[model samples]
Target: MALKQIWEETNMKIIVKDLSPVLLQTKNVFEVADQKLFRYGHLVLPCLSQNYGPTYFCKLEKIN
Candidate 1:
């Protein structure tokens, strides 16, 4: 959740998959955790998370 907090500090909306199963199951929306990220994108962070493992960041609509 620390990474998510950092993103929020910078005004970015990130979906840290696994944390939300319903969101992951959503069709044609976005692919998160376990699945390989971006066929056209690159790794953003090479660090570890305290709550989530080997963190995978997903961009999603912001929630207010």
Candidate 2:
């Protein structure tokens, strides 16, 4: 599913490169942000390098 679809269905807000307490998932791993956040996924991959690469998978949801 598309990111927008996921957001609408899950009612979650996701901000790439923005620090927040939102949920983030990558390659089956889900992480709850406590600090800085980065953008990942298909679109972000091209701009990323080997040292700092984008996550292959991602999922997010609201806390409250």
**Best candidate per lDDT, number?**
1
Supply candidate 2's per-residue lDDT for 1: 46
Q: For residues 1-64, what per-residue lDDT tens digits would candidate 1 score against the true structure?
A: 5655668677666544333445546434343433354532223333344232333444444444
Residues 1-64, candidate 2, lDDT per residue (tens digit)? 4766857887666643432323343423433332324354332333233344344544444454
Write down the TM-score for model 2.
0.24
Candidate 2 residue-wise lDDT at 51: 48
Clashing pairs in 2: none
> What TM-score would each prediction reach against the true structure?
0.21, 0.24
- List ranges where model 2 is wrong by over 4 Å: 18-64
Top candidate when judged by TM-score against the true structure: 2
Number of colliding residue pairs in each model = 0, 0
Native-referenced Cα lDDT, model 2: 0.43
